[model samples]
Target: MSDTLRIVLIVASVLCLLFMLRKISQSKVRIDDAIFWIVGAFVLVIISIFPQIPSWCCDLLGIQTPVNFLFLFMIFILLVKLFYMTIRVSQLESKVKELSQRYALDHMDDEVKQDEK
Candidate 1:
């Protein structure tokens, strides 16, 4: 990687790590959600400090360059996160629907008794 790219990656990763730490301390983000950002920042810092890691990965993956490998790595990580988020959202939607139906059933008799009065 170029000097500029290395510097930017290191700076950005450190900033990200710090931001995640602050958020965790404030209870702004769940540990599960923040885990990805924390891990990604560490991976980035490692690659930035030792550029040969990406260089070797590029050769193994048959990617044209180290930069391409880095981007692919990031995108893969994001895609996995997105998939998990989708699954979680689906589970939440089903739970909400179930709770709403149960609530309506539980209250139906009360509504009828009030109307009868």
Candidate 2:
């Protein structure tokens, strides 16, 4: 990558890191979720500073280009994150449904008792 491009990437990564930290501080983002983004931004800054690391990874993996390797790695990470988020959402939905059902049953029981009295 060109020096200019590397500098741009580093600046962007730093911006992203700052944004994540700000969001965490504001409670806009959960710490667990922010951790992934923070780590990703740090990795981006490191790779931008040491472009050779990606190249070395590409060579080790027999990949043709550093850019391709980075894209592939990023896609894999995003997919894993997506899968975990899906599971978490499903669990939350289930809990909500269960709570709703319990609440309805409790209310119905109270109404029935009042009717009997």
Candidate 3:
């Protein structure tokens, strides 16, 4: 990897890490969610520090270049995170639907009791 790319990676990773930390401090992002970003930044920093790692990975994966490998790696990680988020959102929606139904039942029972009284 070129020094320019290395420097850019390190800078970007540090910025990302810092941004996530700031978000966590502001209560804008949950720790679990920020964890993915934090880990991603760490990986970026690692690759920046150890160019050989990406080179070896590119060779093993038959990728044309380290830049291509980096892009692919990042895209894959983000896609996995997106998939997890989709599942999580679905689970939350299910729970909300269940709770809404339960609440409606309880409300109906209260109205019926008042009517009988």
Query: Top model by TM-score, which number?
Result: 3
Q: How many clashes (backbone N, Cα, C below 3 Å) per candidate? A: 0, 0, 0
lDDT of 3 by residue, 91-116 (tens): 99999999999999999999999999
Output the number of the lDDT-best candidate. 3
Estimate the lDDT of model 3: 0.93
In order of appearance, the predictions have TM-scores of 0.85, 0.86, 0.89
Each model's C-alpha lDDT?
0.92, 0.91, 0.93
Q: For residue 31, what is the lDDT in candidate 3? A: 100
Q: Is candidate 2 or candidate 3 better by TM-score?
A: 3
RMSD of 3: 1.4
Point out the worst 10-residue segment of candidate 1 by lDDT.
33-42
Q: In model 1, where do residues sit more than 4 Å from their true spots? A: 112-117
